[model samples]
Structures are given as structure tokens and as C-alpha cells.
Target chain A: LAKTTQPISMDSYEGQEVNITCSHNNIATNDYITWYQQFPSQGPRFIIQGYKTKVTNEVASLFIPADRKSSTLSLPRVSLSDTAVYYCLVPNAGGTSYGKLTFGQGTILTVHP
Target chain B: EPEVTQTPSHQVTQMGQEVILRCVPISNHLYFYWYRQILGQKVEFLVSFYNNEISEKSEIFDDQFSVERPDGSNFTLKIRSTKLEDSAMYFCASSERSGLAGYNEQFFGPGTRLTVL
Candidate 1:
């Protein structure tokens, strides 16, 4: 498992773009950068995932640099409903680990009206 | 979208009592996992199951915790003896494939809030 570091909290307003960055200096070659979102009293939901470069989906985009030591989750046109805790994980996606997720404290994003 | 489902949105029990948490994973998912989160704390992985057997577990799983796929559609976690420390939200998740095949994106359930006194 690769340890990840992220901001404790971030604030954003409606219609604004929010970017959260995670640093995992010890990420492994077989590891993939994954992000999850959790609203109050709910389970973590998968947002986006990527191995390298950039990957975009209906909800968000993941940007991984060439070094892969860090990654960024970019959310466009944020709304109050988007307020949640965002987790950045570097899980070994090609080993015998069985895909168990290890979550950190995560970055709490609060969207204002 | 087919999502994982857990039973007993909330459960209250006494210390030393046993409790079973049940989950119905996505119909096509092959891998199942259990995770817990104490209030204001990070979510912690308890165990992972595949092919009706445990594939991995954290130190927290210990002897008190056990998992079973009693039938084709249901997966369960049993705590033989509950402690005050066991009070937390238990989340059940399922994945279509294991890490061995590369992509292993897991879908999570709403979670069971367990309160032990």
C-alpha cells in the first residue's frame, strides 16, 4: 500500500472549479491512482481512477504527472451537493492484494452557496 | 446502476454480544470487502473475500471477526464479541474483479451503523 497525503480541507463556491492534490512519493509501479467521495453518513463512492497521464469521466478528471508521485482530482462547476470528503488512494492493482482499499483521512471539500 | 446493499441501517447491542451484518453485493461482482469507520476517523479495511474464501485481512480483523458467503446472493460479517470500541459504521463493498486482473474498482454500500454499549 502506498501512503497518500492531501489537504485536510478545501473551500469552494458554486460554479467554481475545485482541484485537490494528493502526494504519494512511495507509489509502486503497479499501483493505480484512485479517488473516492463520501458524503455525510454514507459509504465512499468511486469518482475516478487512472494509471498515468489523464483520465476523465462524467463526474471528474484525474491528472497524473509523468513521475506518478502525485495526482490531482479536478471537479468542474462545483455545487453544494458536491461537498464531501475526497480520498486519494494508490492501490496495488496488479498484485495479490485482492483490491482491498486503504483509506486515509482524506480531503474534506465544502462547497458554499 | 447495480449497487451493493447492506441490512440493518442501524444496530444497537451490548458488550460481549454477537452481531451479524449482512450484505448483498452487485449481481456480477466476485470480490467482497468489509471496512469500518469510527466517528471522525478514516475508514479502515477489515477484510476482503473472493471465491468464498478470505484473500486478505488487516490486524484489526483478529479472532473476533469472521466473514461468510452463506449463500449465492448474501455475504456476512460476524463479530463474536462486541466491544465499545466496535461502535462505528460498517461498510460492505464489492468489486467485479480482483487486483490480479489489474482494474479493481469497488462499489460500496450505504453502511451499517453499529453501536455497542
Candidate 2:
């Protein structure tokens, strides 16, 4: 499994856009970047995933450069309800390592009024 | 959309006692996983089950830990002997496919808070 590093915390205001970047310099060929959002006292929820370039969803957007060394999760017009810890994971696609996700400290986003 | 569900939202047990955590994955999902999060720590993967067998597990999933489907709709994780270190939030997740098979999205349940005395 490739290790990912992201900001420990971030502060954003309501109605503003927030972007959290994760760096995985040793990403494998079959590795895919997956982002999960975890609110206090709840389970982590899937936000967005991407292999390269850009992928957008109803909740957020994931951007991965061609190098695949890093990726960014962008949340638009954030709200206080969006405050949570975001985890960026890179799991191998095949073999035993498959389906085993190693989570990092995660970026805790704090939305304020 | 159907989501994963867990039972006994909270559990308190004594050290050396046994405990079973239950989960009901999404009806159509094929892959099931168990993860634990210690207070103020990152989520750690324990095991993943597919097709009635374990596909993979982490070092954290030692002999003390076991997973069973038991029936058609329920997946369970059992700890033979609980310890203080076992206190944490256990999360159950399910994916439509294995990571090798496709872009897998593992949906997670609210989690079971296990406290070992």
C-alpha cells in the first residue's frame, strides 16, 4: 500500500471553496486515489476517487495530475455541516494488498461562519 | 440507497471476555470489510471478505480476531478475548466489487463503539 500525506487541519469559511491535497510520491501503477469524509462520531463516507486527471461528483471533485504523485479534493461552497476529517487513501489494485486501505492522520476541515 | 448497518451501537465488556460485532452490508454488495479506529487515531483496516472467504487481512487482525458471514445478509467480527487495547470504534463496510475488479466504493456503517474494561 502506498502511504499518503495530507494537511493535519484546515480552516474554511462557509460559502468558500476548500481544497485539500494529498501527496503519495511512491504510488504504484495500479494504485487509485480514494478520498473519504468522516464526521465526528460516525463512520467514514466515500467522497470521490480518481486515477488521474479530474473526476467530479455531486459532493466533491478529485484532481490527479499526470504524475499521479499527488491529488486534490475540492469541496465547493462549503457549509458548517461539511466540517469533518477527510482521508486520502491509495490502495493497490491486485493481490493481497488489494482492498486494504491504510488511512493517514487525515485533513480535518473546520468550517466557520 | 441501501447502506451498511451495525448492531448494538455500543458494547462494554471486561478484559478476557468475548464479543461479537454484527453488520449488515448493502443488499447487493459483494465485498465486506472491517476496520477499527482508536480514539484520536486513524482508521485501520482489519480484514476484507469476498465470496464467503477472507480476501485479505492486516497484521492487526491477529488470531484473536475472526470474521464470519454466518448467514446470507449478516457479517460479523468476533474477538475471542477482549483487552484494553481493543477499545475502539469498529466500522463495517461493503463494496460492490473488489478493488482489482473495478472502482470500488466501500460504504461504511455508523460503527460499533467497543469499550473493554
Candidate 3:
């Protein structure tokens, strides 16, 4: 499995946008970039995933550059309820990879009301 | 909007006691897995089960830890002898079948919090 690195913490104000980036220089050629948002005391929830370029969803957007070495998770108009730990996984959403989710120390997003 | 469900949301067991954590995966899913998260720590995979057998397991899953799909609807994790260090929130997840016969995008349940005292 490919390893991922991301910021440990990020601060954002309500109504502001927040972006967390992750680096996986050794990403496999078939690897996809996936992001999960986990609330305190709950399971990690699926956010968005992408192989390259950009992918958007109702909750967040994933921006992957041409290199595929890194990806960004963008949350728009953040709210205090959005405060949670976000994890960026290397190409690991529903494939032959199975559930080998080696979670990194996720980025804790603190939103000030 | 189907979801996986677990029984006994909270279990309090004494050290060296036997405990079983139960989970029911999504009906159509073909894969089952167990994961645990100690307090204030990241979730760790315990084991993955497919084709009525274990496909992979972590170091944490020792001989004391065993899993069984006793029936079509129930998947269980049994810890032969509980320890204080085993106190954690255990989660059950299931996923559809992937092309290579591996699990697909896994959906998790609320989790069963086991407190080993």
C-alpha cells in the first residue's frame, strides 16, 4: 500500500474555504486519490475521490494535478459542524485494494463559529 | 439507505473474560471486515473475511481473536481473553464484490464500544 502525508492540523473560520493537501510521491500507477472525513467518535465518512484532474461532490471537491503525486481536498463555506479529521488515502476506495486503510495522522480542521 | 448494524452498542467485560462483538453487514455486500480504534487513536484494520475465510489480518489479530460468520446474516468477533488494553471501539464494515473477487467500497456500522476493565 502507498503511504500518504498531510498536515496535522488546520484552522478555518466559518464561511471560509479550507483546503488540505496530501503527498504520495510513490503512488502506484493505478492508484487513485481518495479523501475521507471523520467526525469525532464516529467512523470515517467518504468525501470524494479522484484519479487525476478534479472531482467535485456535494460535500467537498478533490483537485489532483497532472503529476498524481499529490491531491487536495477543498471544503467550501465551512461551518463549526464541519470540524473533523480529514484523511487522504492513496487510491483506496473500493477496488481490489481491500480494506487496508492505513490511516495517517489525519488533519484536524478546527472551525471557529 | 441501508446500513450495517451491530448489537450491544456497549459491552463491559472484565479482564481475562471472553467477549463477542456482533455485526451485520449490508445485505448485498460480499465482503466483511473488522476494525478497532483505541481511544484517541486512528482506526486499525483487524481482519478481512471473504469467501467464508479470512483473506488478511493485522498483527493485532492474534490467536485470542477469532471471527466467525455463524450464519448468513451475522458476523462475529470473539476475543478469547480480554485485556485492559483491548478496550476500544470496534467497527464492522462490508463491501460489494470487486472484479478480482476482493471487497469493494466498504460501508461501516455505528460500532460496538467494548470496555475491558
Looking at model 1, give its docking quality level: medium
Candidate 2 scores an fnat of 0.63
Candidate 2 lDDT tens digits, B92-114:
99988778843658899999999
Comparing only chain B with the true structure, the TM-scores of all models are: 0.97, 0.97, 0.94
Residue-by-residue lDDT tens digits, candidate 3, A18-91:
99999999887777677877887777776876788998989999899999889999999999999999988774
Q: Pick the candidate with the highest lDDT.
A: 1
How high is the CA lDDT of each candidate model? 0.94, 0.92, 0.85
- What is residue A72's positional error in candidate 3, in angstroms? 0.1
User: Residue B109 deviation, candidate 1, in Å?
Assistant: 0.4
The count of backbone overlaps in candidate 1 is 0
- Per-residue lDDT over B28-95 for candidate 3, one digit per residue giving the tens place of the 0 to 100 score: 88888898999889889899898899987889999999999999999999999999999999999887
Interface RMSD of the predictions, in order shown? 1.3, 1.6, 4.1
Which candidate wins on DockQ? 1
lDDT of 1 by residue, B45-91 (tens): 99999988999999999999999999999999999999999999999
**Reference-based lDDT, residue A80, model 3:** 96
Model 2 chain B is weakest, by summed lDDT over 10 consecutive residues, at B96-105
Q: What is the DockQ of each candidate?
A: 0.77, 0.68, 0.41
For model 3 the local lDDT of residue A81 reads 97
Q: Of the candidates shown, which would achieve the greatest TM-score relative to the real structure?
A: 1
Candidate 1 recovers a fraction of native contacts equal to 0.76
Task: Give candidate 1 misplaced runs (Cα > 4 Å).
Answer: none
Clashing pairs in 2: none
